[model samples]
Target: MADIQDFKSTPKYETFSYLPPMTPEKIRRQIAYLVSQGWNPGIEHVEPARASAYYWYMWKLPMFGEQSVDVIIAELEACHRAHPGNHVRLIGYDNYSQSQGTSFVVFRGK
Candidate 1:
């Protein structure tokens, strides 16, 4: 007889999905890296159930030419406030490459 599988599978999202939840300090560091790389930052949110969907709702226009990590964090907080039950993610868009350079979940919905 074949052996039976006993483990369950979990869905993995964007960057850092395999790691534990990030702290505020860690998040700030990530934002700083984004700024240092000159990549535009954007926020998007979606319900936990629909997190695997192809699209998410944009919080606002990407912060172009903004170098302040504080500003980015504030915007992320605001998006969380507006969508407390949604999974929120921060994405870094590379203008030169015209593609997304980094993406990670900043907040997980209940």
Candidate 2:
């Protein structure tokens, strides 16, 4: 993964999503926390019809505030990259998503 600073500078988030068969409570909380901080989250389905690998998710940390955007993204980028296999999926931009300026780091796992 690239340096966290790179992530922070970027205007768009490297977002991702998943549709697996798992609750992933811990990740859900983390995601919610990030969203509260000012990041966009992707739409999720409860055990969709299509079969998939084990349920998992991961994503780049997006900037929440203008002043803290770089700082937040850098910090989260370091943490996320330090352990790629950890963080779950990050929400993508949608109707209820945040502003266009905000950026997010997104990923998923199985």
Each candidate structure's TM-score, on Cα atoms with residue i matched to residue i, is 0.89, 0.26
Question: Tens digits of per-residue lDDT for model 2 on 1-110?
Answer: 33234434333213322222234454445555655655444322112212134443333433333233344334544555665554423343433443442222333322
Best by TM-score: 1
The sequence of per-residue lDDT tens digits that candidate 1 reaches over residues 47-109 is 989989669999989989889999999999999999999989999999999999899999889
Error of 2 at 107 (Å): 3.1
Off by over 4 Å in 1: 1-10
**Candidate 2 lDDT:** 0.37
| Clash count, candidate 1 | 0
Best by lDDT: 1
Residue-level lDDT for 16 in candidate 1: 82
What's the distance in Å from true for residue 76, model 2?
1.7
